[model samples]
Target chain A: AQTVTQSQPEMSVQEAETVTLSCTYDTSESDYYLFWYKQPPSRQMILVIRQEAYKQQNATENRFSVNFQKAAKSFSLKISDSQLGDAAMHFCAYSFNFGNEKLTFGTGTRLTIIP
Target chain B: SQTIHQWPATLVQPVGSPLSLECTVEGTSNPNLYWYRQAAGRGLQLLFYSVGIGQISSEVPQNLSASRPQDRQFILSSKKLLLSDSGFYLCAWTGGPGETQYFGPGTRLLVL
Candidate 1:
């Protein structure tokens, strides 16, 4: 079984500032994928960023990026130039390359952007 | 482009009432479908998944059940609604294994 953990329950960042949300996971598989999803007040789950284990380079999508340390089993999300729209519940998820492709998700971190 | 849709954006039902939530996908064929529930201030819990029509895989054993009557349609049903079942239900689809899963707007279910 695999499990994902987000130690930070909440995070805050000033507009134009940056914030990093922590995430870690326990998995026996060496090759897998990590993802960060955002759920805004509308309750729509949106994909933030994705990291492939085989790739050493981190994944960055505009203002959103991830610091993936495969050896440490840590995948943290970094939001740069945070805006009000960035405020939402962020979740870290893990999935294997094969099988049913079921995702194991972390508890979630509520992000608040202060003006 | 592929799109997933979940109906009944919001539902309120009394305890012991029957419940049904519908999900459909457009512009995709033979996609993998998934049903997830998110309680207030919590992460998502995978309720069920289907690789094809009439093939369902249940991840959690609870009051809810799921069925995929058609390749692009998935339904989440409950014979008797429970307060514990109140949550935001999300429907997702993926082209194949390891592909990025896309989510629907989701339905907010409230059981009284």
Candidate 2:
């Protein structure tokens, strides 16, 4: 069994500033994948970024990036130049490389972008 | 490109009623489909997943059941609804293992 943890329940960032959402997971498998998903007010889940456990280099997607420490079992999401649209519920997910490919998600962190 | 569709977008059902949520995928064949439920202010819980037609895997023991009648059609159902079933239901699909799962618009289910 695998579990993901998001210590922060809520976070706020001023517009144009940067914010980091912390995430940790418990998994015995060495090969896996990590993901960050954003759910806005519309209630649509959108993929933000992804990182592979085998890769030491973090994943960056435009204004979003991840600090993935495989040894520490931590994968954190960083949002640079945060916009109002970035205000949403962020979730960290973990999945192994094989099997059913099911994702185990953290409780989630509600992000609020202040003007 | 692949796309997923879930409906009726929003649903309000009375307690003890039945449930049938449908999910369909376009532009792909034999994709892995999944059903997830998100309670209020919470993350997603994987309920069921199917790798192919007539193959369903349940992650938890619950009141719900899922079926894959066709390669691109997945359905989640329950004989009777419970208040606990009230949540946002999301349908997702992935091309293969280790692939990024794409989500549909989701269905907001309210069990009154």
Candidate 3:
């Protein structure tokens, strides 16, 4: 079984500043996918960024990027130029590379973008 | 563009009452469907997932059961509800296993 851990339960960042949310996972599977999801008060899950275990290069999507260290089993998300809209609960999830593998999520980190 | 719709946006029921939540997807076929439960201030927990019609995989052993009657429709049902079942239920779909999932607005169920 794979377990995801988000050591930071709460985080705050000033507007326009950068923030990094930490995530670590324990998985024996060599082929897997890692994701970061955001859920605001609306309770809708939004995909932030993704990283494949095989990819040595990190994944970046606009302001959101991931620092994936496969050897360390760490995948952290970095939000650059953070805005008030970035205030939400962020979750780190893991899944297999195969068909319909269910996602295992971390406890979550509540992010507050301070203005 | 694809979208997922989950119904009754909010629901309130008494303990031991029966429950049913419907979820449907549009603009996609043979997609993987999933049901998740979110407790207050907690991350989404995978309850059930379906890869095809009449096939359901339950991740957590709970009072709820899921059924995929059609390729694009998934339903979560409970014969008798429990207070522990009170939470936000979210429906999600993905193009494949490794693909990112798109989630619905979620149904807020409160069992009193």
**Which pairs clash in the backbone of model 2?**
none
What's the true lDDT of residue B69 in model 2?
Answer: 99
Where does model 2 exceed 4 Å of error? none
Query: Model 3 chain B, poorest ten-residue lDDT window?
Result: B94-103
DockQ of each: 0.78, 0.84, 0.82
* Alpha-carbon lDDT, every model: 0.94, 0.95, 0.95
How does model 1 fare in lDDT?
0.94
lDDT of 2 by residue, A1-115 (tens): 8999999999999999999999999999999999999999998999999998989899999999999998899999999999999999999999899867899999999999999
Q: Which stretches of candidate 3 lie over 4 Å from their true place?
A: none
Candidate 3: Cα lDDT at B63? 98
Query: Given candidate 2, what's the lDDT at residue A16?
Result: 100
Q: Please give, for residues B2-52, the per-residue lDDT of candidate 1 as tens digits.
A: 889999999999999999999999998999999999999999999999999
Docking class of 2: high
Q: Model 2: C-alpha RMSD to truth?
A: 0.8
- Candidates' interface RMSDs, in order? 0.9, 0.9, 1.2
TM-score of each: 0.98, 0.98, 0.98
